[model samples]
Target: VQDNLEGALTEADIEPLNMPEMDRDELVEGESFKFTLLCQVKPDIELKGLDALTVNRELVEVGDTEINAEIEGLREQNAELEPVEDRGSETGDIVTFDFVGTLDGEEEPFDGGSGTEHPLELGSGQFIEGFEDQLIGVKEGDERVVDVTFPEDYQAEHLAAKLAHFACTVKSVRCKALADVDDEFAVDLGHDDLSALRASVYDRLFEAATKEKDGDVREQLLKGLMEANEIEIPAALIEMAQKQLQNQMGMHLAMNGMPRDQIAQAMESETEGVLERAKEMAHRDLLLDAAAVEGDISVSDDELEERIGEIAVDMNQPKAKVRASLQENDRIHSVRGEMLHEKTLRWLEEQASSVSGDSTSASAEGNPTADDASDSNVEVADEES
Candidate 1:
């Protein structure tokens, strides 16, 4: 309908207000028919007095303390685990075991409550609260009946708040041996030496801090603009925005170990937050589009070629090949849109009084730190990845 209406009515953009029902029963067979479409154009926004808006873009400080912490994290990641055969299992040890669980007083083991030779880090909270504590003193080949009560909000409907016992045996206990932070450690991680590694980490950290500050500035600009010019969001967009956000939050919870069966209930509990976020998304999109028009932000052929040339360099492919691939995948417009969006945001950032960002316009030629894969940038790599 958007394309057809745009062609018929000569309108550039059209947003449908509602999905109207059509009457087809009265049309005769082989007879010519005509239909009219009624679409509500989404509001075109005007960004006025943006130059007077004051949004603080505090520059994040990158200190030696932060650098040291990041380096320490790398050291921890490179640590090796060594078996401790002489002692019984203790906190911080990785223990391997087998176990079967039954309801506190039941005669038989319960379903989905047994494991053999599973390795679990003691005190990691990977299991029920009391389960790991019981393994703390158990030696290899030792057996103990461990008791624990499931949490009230446990995902399993039948097992929530229930007590269970596991007859277990320990196979081994191991402790981590942290690497020494030295030139050798840096060399092992493919860096020339400790100094070189620190320099690289520093550069990376500074870049990250800059990007974070830039994002904060953009957010404040949009928030101030939206507050100044409020519009009621249509129902269709509200439903769409709410569902996408709800699913995203639910997926995050699931990835962090929440069971799927309870995600629906958890999402239901977050109805208000989801609605507000949905409204914010819709509002930001509207304002950005309006700002794009108001500022006349566009991606000229030369600017697009410049961005694609950079993309080709990043992808290690020739510019011609990369452009061909993008065109083949129907992603040329998406790339253009991303560039346009960035240009629009850069325009808004220019209006701010205090911002920690590059003075160069987004389309300007330079080693732009913008690998900004717009919402569309996500799709270009789908088939290839």
Candidate 2:
């Protein structure tokens, strides 16, 4: 069988040829024709010594100082916005005020600039340039006018390159963050206490650091493997990718109630860009899969579940919803393919040579167990229950 397969593969051109011997009788059921397919394998690149593929490992050392800094960041993350008492508007202070603007000192061309108690953060660049700058040092019950110019390339065609003056009134000011990052803060975050918050923060930071470092190693290995391998990818794959992009984009626009003509016009321009990207991505996939198959690397179901769960967490969506969407869209298959690529890259990294920095090496003390790549391919539940 191996010899026959090899012989069949050798006869193929740059593109893969169908293998009639591998055809399944099931494919002949109903009105469909039956034929076996032998996907022409792209030229495989030989990966050498597990140690010869030069790579850099950030040899991260996670000590108490780093942990503390991470914890402090968490505290800032949990910081609260509170109304200020007896505070005036200053740079960086969020202000609620009423204002009107005029084009050439006249209100006729500047409608909609008038509002009561509008919220603006000083120095936030939320308003016209220099508008916020004028708000600095203004207290409640104060009023001032500021001169500014709209940029030549402003989005609003009518106002582009127009000079305008804002007639301003300061109503109230809210000060900087006053949230207490103590036990109360933890409770606010729905945790038991500050210690629990710290523990959670630590776990999150450790996971983030590990992921970043591992991803770096994997990317470097893939870059090397891609450079080493020669592969032939079908032009049809790029066309398919472009069509898929158009369909997805169209679906998104339709969901938002965009018009047909608008979508068609947009697709005409975007299709070219998408095609180029798809070609590059297809080439990368071909090489990665070939390298992975040679190395016997693959992803397990458990890893997919974990990754899906992580995506859900990041998107603030329910795991069940995400799982359903992935399954319905055939995205689960795509996810598996992505996971396979990641696994192959990691395997290459393991066999490759590496260097480390002092900061990375210093943080090597007592980090938790690495997310084991071997434990992948097993089914992982979205919830413990």
Candidate 3:
């Protein structure tokens, strides 16, 4: 006979429970046993006041100042450095030099104390604050001794707030020539003219701002929904979420060029913070899933395929290749879950009331762009175990 105290539970489902030990010798071969299994189930999440939730959508306006800033950035990107023979070192000029630094009255130089043919930008503040200023009037071949004090919070503990002297030699100076913001620059960047480039930039910025605003509104709605709902999350789910977070963090570090040893070291210091964040994320995801079920929201195979196609296009890969890779990595479910979350958020947005603010500009901090929203939806899809 099968155990029915917990209502037709299998071994896999019954693992996370307090079950009493059973002696196999007490039963014969092919014989069954009956026992009680005490277990906890997923809590019921009642999402209320969703329709009454009010969120503010900040409308960000692209102005002339932002447009000009973009133009300036483009100009900087197109700038060229030309050697300057007539003038001494000055702000905005690149200076090349050699130097040996030592602490006061010390015969031995400090660690990382000497370098040759080092090219530095005068006003870039790459060196200590006073070190660059002392080189302002120095000519080529001029030998000078620069004095400066490291900041109290300097990275090197031994050098913190320490006075140091550098015996320096001026080598060469180069000034940057920025390309003019005109038709030629526009043509070089594949645009028709200056006006055309400006218009394109404005359109792109406006689109980004709009997407960012939508993301902010969605976040506010999610926060409101969570506040209106009360539920208890399972400990097993939290542990699973924490493990997923650790894996994601490791992957992120590896992708960003962090070595295995360094990643391990960094993770050691970040475990507590990561676990807390995992709990919060897990709680939010549980609430979202419950809300989706209540609203009869679901992801279809066609919808999942469409999203996969979009991903392939975005990544510039073949559709079949992308699908194969996702399948190999077992991330197809993640894509489906992300789509479902997106649909749920859209539904929530429609059901709730929103007010557009009168402000013409706003920062996009803590906001989600269309791309961010998509990532957020997929982030927890495969993590839920």
For candidate 1, write residues 1-385 as lDDT tens digits.
4445547654644446456433334566897666666445566556665767668867466555566678878865777778887777778778898999999879898878999999998998999998899888777788899999999987676789999999998777777776666667779999876666666666677778778877888888887888787887666767767887987898899998776767777788789988988988878777777888988788899999999999999999999999999999888987997788789998997777874444222212212122321111111111100
Task: Using TM-score as the measure, name the better of candidate 1 and candidate 3.
Answer: 1
Candidate 2's displacement at residue 240, Å, is 4.4
Clash totals for all candidate models? 0, 16, 0
- lDDT score, residue 122, model 2? 85
> Evaluated with TM-score, which candidate comes out highest?
1
The models' CA-based lDDT, in order, is 0.75, 0.67, 0.76
Off by over 4 Å in 2: 1-52, 61-87, 98-117, 125-129, 141-147, 150-169, 177-199, 230-233, 239-279, 298-328, 357-385
TM-score of decoy 1: 0.74
Reference-based TM-score of each model: 0.74, 0.61, 0.73
- The candidates, ranked best first by lDDT, are 3, 1, 2
Residue 91's lDDT in candidate 1: 84
The TM-score of predicted model 2 comes to: 0.61
Q: RMSD in Å for candidate 1, one decimal?
A: 10.1
Q: In candidate 2, how many Å is residue 285 off? A: 1.5
Q: Rank by TM-score, descending?
A: 1, 3, 2
